[model samples]
Target: MNHTLAWRLVSGVKINHLCTPRIAIPSKAVTGSQQVREFSTSYKRSTVMPAWVIDKYGSNEVLRLNNNTEFPIIHYPNEVIVKINATSLNPIDVNMRNGYGSASLNMSRDPLNVKTTGCEFPLVLGRDLSGVVMECGLNVRYFKPGDQVWGAVPPWKQGTLAEFVVASGNEISMKPKSLSHTEAASLPYVTLTAWAALVNSCRLNKQKCPGKRILIIGASGGVGTAAIQLLKAWGGHVTAVCSEDAFSLIKDIGADEVIDYKAEKLEEQLKSKQPFDVILDNVGGTTEKLALQFLKPWSGATYVTLVTPFLYNNDRLGIADGMMRTGVTLSSKVVKHLCKGVHYRWGFFSPSGQSLDEIGLLVENGQIRPVIDEIFPFSEVPKAFSKVEKGHARGKTVIRVTESSK
Candidate 1:
């Protein structure tokens, strides 16, 4: 199995968990009127969760399935253990498989860089997950055992690829009731990217959002689809760029204008539209450069891209030179774009339970909907990662982690 074993998060998860034990099943978390016993770590973690892990980074060839993988545990206050129901795949997971961030992985070993460190082998990798909370730390307040939740974990830690993963309370929220675990698992990573790019970087929050015009490139992918829905929720005019086949789904999600990337010259379409307040780009390099023509100049229009740190150089040049060169190259681009009154920044996903709560509200109110491309059984994870690596998925690809029905 690989990236798509129905995947899922860590920190103020408000969850981390291990193998499942058959216990008295409660439909929901223990609340005010319900009488339930709290979980203790000493309780048998007799079950071993299976996981797909890598001892050393490489391509898909390095992944090994270990059915006896130790169940995850919680040693920190504010932590909760989660039994992952499903997870999804993204480009980052594929890159990590090929050792794309080996330098950062090595550097994280320094004690001073605690925030940047990832787990040591046998390391599991999956960014986001939706699951049930099995146990809550002694100091944890917001959630309790039996709570259904979802969140994204930092890439530097052991991932949600196993039967369980630990997360802090601040990193997760109760999963939206409208979404099944498979549907909820498709969120997190891409939705967080959309939030970072649009809300955090472009300043499209509630107060400043009416009537703003935004353009989303690669609008058919997961991030693009999420960006479109979020932009609509903020009352912005959305123009989506995708293939003709994707137009229906894009339009259904509330895009004001949908441009077929294949049928039209994108630059020509932008020129006709005049200017946009923000351009949230999923494709980078040349496509990103060309799209600069449409920014609403003098208004300090922002251009945010989900691609950054330009890994191509890392592969061509060695690590140190590649890093130095990336810094110089990025600085040049930032300066050039800044002078034209456009702010350019890279988008990175940061998990926030607060943000998840807001998104859940949106989901409950029917403001946004999850877009799933395909679902692979847990055992077929390598095929799922390959699909993401090929970069042709229509929306998000999900994995079914357990054989049981939701």
Candidate 2:
């Protein structure tokens, strides 16, 4: 009888077969026996979904949304999958589309590849996203599925211009309760830049910020707008340089002083205001040199340049690293500090979920608000990118990718 049963089991009839090395096939007389086959339910795998994608580095014409179908799938233990609600455009995106930066446009390639294939074309472009958490990786502890979140994606990973995006657990924070998806979508990159510049680089604490005179060059831009609010909220007096058209907008956002750079020479205007303690110079050109003139002695002012000045030689100006070690000796007299009171610095934004969360709280409490200049549908993403490239937008340009209510 046992031989007959074993023969039937190994004959591949119905569901009868080896269960595994540890578990044996049951006989028909088993208590839970049924007419159908039985399989192990203990080790079921997780499911994955698709995303829109791009493959090559080129213009907007090169973007093909049919790829990245499985984009939000977790490839790393610290990843969290999000259903992108909306994404905003940035100048970096344009550079990325043009294959200007390190991001890929198509097939993934190793950095060591002899050819340019390492960049991988058909890459996703949008960096900042407002979305809902659809899934979380096993190691993700700060967030769970169904949470409303928004923040920047890791620089080299798949971006947020698709239906789904995967971000490191530390790359996102909870969405501000006061902001709609459209409003929150405009913030991440720009606000993070402002935060890093003001808090991390400048090290302006709220107590120390009171009564300090600060000037923001290019005050009407995305980063500038956020800086204006942050500076003012911390009790610093802010002076902004902008075009005539954006003067009122800058003032409305809490700028105590405004300069229309297009209408007048920057130095002539600032000479009337004397030296500033901090100059957050965003524009490069004559404006940069003018900002350097307004720094108070012993007061450190930072000039964050978008355009690197290759023509200006720091070595020739006696501003190199070696110059600092040997204190300036004039006529055998030691000069501890220079009279032209200002410090120069270059800054870039780094991704951080904790910083994003703090900024979100400020936004929720009305301490700051994202300046949203335009909202475009996902299908119109190309047009949005063009708008950002024009460099005239007063605030941020966003792309609505998914239904926010969902």
How high is each candidate's TM-score?
A: 0.85, 0.77
Worst 10 residues of 1 by lDDT: 1-10
Best candidate per lDDT, number? 1
lDDT of each: 0.80, 0.70
Q: Which segments of candidate 1 are over 4 A away from where they belong?
A: 1-47, 109-119, 310-326
Residues 1-406, candidate 2: write the lDDT tens digits.
1211211221122323322221234546556443322221111112223334567666778766563254345656677778888888887788767665342222123444456544454567788988897656556777877789999975567788887777988999999888887888899988888887777767786777999888899889898998899888889999998999998899899999898877877678888996777777677667766677677766565545554422122222333432332233221221222334445565566788999988887787787987889888887777887788889779999888866623
User: 1-406, model 1: which lDDT tens digit per residue?
Assistant: 1111110122234232332323223448956654322333423443468998988878888888888888776767788888899999888888888888756655544536454334477888898889998777767778877889989887777888788888988889999999999989998888888997888888779678778889899999989988888878988899998889998999999999988877778787777785888998888868888988788888978898888765656656756788889899879988998898888877778888889899889888889888999999889888888889888568899888977526
Listed per candidate, the RMSD to the true structure in angstroms reads 7.8, 10.4
